[model samples]
Target: MTDSTPSLDLLLAGYVLNTLSQEEAALLEQYLAADPTLQERIDQLQATLEAAYATPEVKPPPQLRMAILAATEALPSQQTEALPSQQTEALPSQQTEALPSQQEAEPASWARRLPAWQLAFGLAAAIAIAWLGIDNYRLRLAKETAPTEIATETPASESLDYALQPVEADLTAAAQIELNPAELEGELTVAGLPPLPPEQVYVLWTILAPDAPFTADSKGAILTETFNTNAQGNVTESLVLPEAYQTLAQVAAIGITVESADAPQAHQGSPILLTDL
Candidate 1:
């Protein structure tokens, strides 16, 4: 291959790491498409990369360097010491002649005779570099593909506040109801109302509009809650409105009536305090 063209292994590594330039990636794709079997190698590399990433790094023991060095330093002397005995065992003329020829045939480069530890360290360093490359490449790809969230201010819920009007203009009783349509909840605040006896209680009612959906009550009034006033004839109660309360369009009005505490849903009495929606 020309100097400009990367070897197959280099191209595969670059492709797996996603570090290939446009032209290099195109070249690799062409080769991969031509040989469909190359996909298996790609998958293997991907799996290996994932495994390496999932593996936790472990530090070498402190004595590892000393052990490796000691072994390497002792190798030459141990080999030299064995040479005389080896020569004696090969005393036959033919065998001795073959030993010298074998030694001569071996590579003369010092790199070929490098200590095992040095070769292993070089390989470990290369793998570490490859892992780092893959990790960084994956992080960059994630950042590029990740969806960005836009900050938005949510509009506040629509709150409906109504004042309860006493049935008799001379009555000093006052009350108010605040409803949150979004949450389908409301609060009832009342003061100066006359306290009822044990047999009677104040029943809140929701009067449905004429076009409201079918309800259990034929009178179009939903019995909301039954509450008792304090000794001081004042009460503040948090009320959970029904789903129908979400839209006032379905409600004709809100009212409070003095009903029999045993059966508040009977709604036998007229509204003592009422508010038209």
Candidate 2:
């Protein structure tokens, strides 16, 4: 209906096949009125089909002809022998009544007569399958309604709080650190601090005691995280602490300082905020 060339071609194919519905025929006629070249294409298609049909027919091989003939000859005898019982079933009511005793003497071959052992085995198998199905359904139902026990972990032990005192008295910027000794994890909350430029970030440092059984940088500090404060100059961050924090004596102190974002671990700056572990 939209006059698309492919759609018109499809309608033309259906027309050639004599398969187009009445509505499709009318639609194609509308297109044909607007496009006279479509008629030439139709004539070319019909001529090609006629040329193909004009090709002389070739006979099948003699052996194939013989095979088909042999199959046809044997079909009637097979049907007659296989369905003798069907003939009796089609008998008139008068004939059936007259030959009642004869019919009883010659039971229909189509009705299978299973042996006693076979019948018993089949019945036992059916019972077993039914029992298994019922048992499976009950098991599934029980699982659906059964209460489930979830293993809940004990809450993390209480954390120790340490206040980070600002070195510059005039600056009211301060922070608090909460360390979970057992879990070796902590949170740092900073307030009243000013945001740094993109190239600079705030870094947290954990300094260890001289004789502690843990590694540290040249300045005896273990760098934790490098972060930037938001426009409000406030940020809360979770950090993983060193194992030495479990024994407060092993950790000397924790601190925060401004550092180059490119190399925060270099520890080039001194602490502006410090907290004794």
Candidate 3:
């Protein structure tokens, strides 16, 4: 479609053989419109062909004619016997050379028939299946390890059931303590305590004699073991009276203290919450 010259070999063959298709002829005509070089080459080839055919034809000499005539007369008996013998002798050598080539070509021809894209797709699918299997295995291992982590890290005595109970200090600042006559067990609910620091907890204490508590050591006796507040700053726990004070219990109090997680010693930290029960 551009102004490039058409192929000279195609043009030469088509012109000599007179076998140009319609499209090829049109292309050659388009090139001739602008390509003077191609036109000159075509003209020169035509002139050379014409000059070759126009050259004189030479006649054979009389002796050469006599020699050809004698050879032609002897050819019939030679063809009847000699040609068959030569052909029979050449057949086995031809077959021997061709058999190995045919065998070698069979495997190569079948190799071309194999589907390259299908093999690539099967490999990709196998890789995807292996990756998914590994991912599922890791997920199952994480699921099995979660409960063990929770059991080891969480406190043993903390009540999971009363996790939502409100604290008593914020409920009533001066609530009176009422002794339970039937049994020496009671529940303590305290709320609005500030969130406990890390490795610190709150302990419930009983004031034995409010009028006689005068020293730091005799301020109050610990009633129940200490426990950490939940993240919501509420403490709810059960209290059991000490055997010595089972009948003589006067007042129960709740106090918040910062203490170590293991073998808590005493209320050594600042008290942020306090209430009489």
Best by TM-score: 1
lDDT of 3 by residue, 1-277 (tens): 3333224454453555465555556656766777657777678756655544454433434654565455555545543442234554567876656554422332222212224443233233333444444555676899999988876764332332122222434532211222332355556665555656766565655544564333324355553557665666566666674443343434344454556655455546545445543
Each model's C-alpha lDDT?
0.71, 0.71, 0.48
Cα error, residue 226 of model 3, in Å, equals: 1.2
lDDT of 2 by residue, 1-277 (tens): 4445545665675576565666567766877898878888788756645544553443435654565455556555554565546777899988877764532332222112333343343334333444444555676887876643211232234578989998878878989999897798989999988999999999999999999988889999999878888999999999898788777888889889999999999999989899886
Backbone clashes for every candidate come to 0, 0, 6
Off by over 4 Å in 2: 1-157
State every prediction's TM-score relative to the real structure. Answer: 0.44, 0.43, 0.29
* lDDT (Cα, tens digit) per residue for candidate 1, span 49-161: 78666656744455555655555666566445533556557588776666644223321212234455654443454456465566667878878766432112212156779
What is the TM-score of candidate 2?
0.43
Model 1 lowest lDDT segment of ten:
147-156
Q: Give per-residue lDDT, candidate 2, residue 49.
A: 52
lDDT rank, highest first? 1, 2, 3
Error of 1 at 30 (Å): 38
The weakest ten consecutive residues by lDDT in model 3 span 103-112
